[model samples]
Target: MPISHQKALPSPIRVVLLNKPFQVLCQFNDEQGRQTLADFIHEPDIYAAGRLDRDSEGLLLLTNHGPLQHRLAEPSQKMPKTYWAQVEGDITEQALQQLQHGVQLKDGLTRPAKSQKIAPPKLWERNPPVRFRQNIPTSWLSLTITEGRNRQVRRMTAAVGFPTLRLIRVQIGPWKLTSLQPGESRDISGDPQIATLLKSPKRKSYRSPRSPQR
Candidate 1:
């Protein structure tokens, strides 16, 4: 009789969605002793798929799978990310149009973005609240972009005459921040659909069907 051999099943992928708080470094370690993802997340094997600036806040994804991480973080993938920005003035329609078309930056002209004026979101108050100017009124915007250039959102708003005062990412690709408060995280490793998607040989690019309204 011939001996039978069987291949072992692959380990389940681990993915974590975290609502990163303002002022926390995106990395796990900080030489300056500043707060980092390590302060909140204890998973040793997982790493941030992409990064948010230390001053920016909201949804950040981490994963243990290298391919999944690359798919999410690579700028060439053109994954859309939605952000809620509180700008320094009553943003104008012209500004929104400019943003929707394209904005010139030092690097190059940015790709066209989906831009709209929106009401201020009901959100957790920041510890060091945004500076308030009694004379100047501020407005909010919901902007979605597919690029990952450094400070792209802030620069885009500033180029159109409204500097971003407070920026919060609300969604990335198909993942929504939802109700997760600052510093809170959820593990989505058991999602069978995500597992299957990761394993698919002919996977399509992930894109949001429509721009996020808020």
Candidate 2:
């Protein structure tokens, strides 16, 4: 049978969903020799869709589909990702509004994004909790954006005077961090809506997606 004549699989090839834990670098290797997805995802050829900082935690998607991977990681496409941030002080309504409008960063003004205070989400225990100051208070804020600027979440919080102490990604496009706890993972069959967004043309002034650290 000709290659084009072969029957297609029942579904799109599956993508790996990893609840990337804190302190695990995004790359396969580190000069400091820390763990990475390679420690868990032994499957070959697949690459990370986007990046989650070593200090940050939560959903990180991986896949072998090149076009889909490029679309997800590409800044031009602006696929929204949601993150839950634990900051060092109470978050005010004004601060959330400022975030939604846009904030000035050293690089430039960030694009408008969504942000709101959220009740502390019940999460799996981190191996080591964030440090405490005897008098300092904290709050949780849920933020979502299409652009994945480097350290953008931390920078955005700091720009508004609430430095983030912990960050967890709760959603990527249509996929959520639901059910999959820290250090656990599952396979996503695929979603057509997300695929449509991925296939769209790259936006002007979009920063090209770089390969994940590893």
Residue pairs that clash (backbone atoms under 3 angstroms), model 1: none
Over the stretch 1-214, how does candidate 1's per-residue lDDT look in tens digits? Answer: 9977978887668999999999999999989999999999998889998889999999999998899888788766777999999999999999999999988887678889999999889999997999978999999999999878788899999999999999999999888899999999999887675665567564355423332221
Segments in model 1 whose C-alpha atoms lie over 4 Å from true places? 1-10, 196-214
How do the residues 16-108 of candidate 2 rate in per-residue lDDT, one tens digit apiece?
889999999877767777888877778777779889999999999888887788777877677799999999999999999999998888767
Worst 10 residues of 1 by lDDT: 205-214
What is the number of backbone collisions in each predicted candidate, taken in the order shown? 0, 2
- How displaced is residue 197 in candidate 1, in Å? 4.7
Candidate no. 2 TM-score: 0.86
- Candidate 1: global Cα-lDDT? 0.89
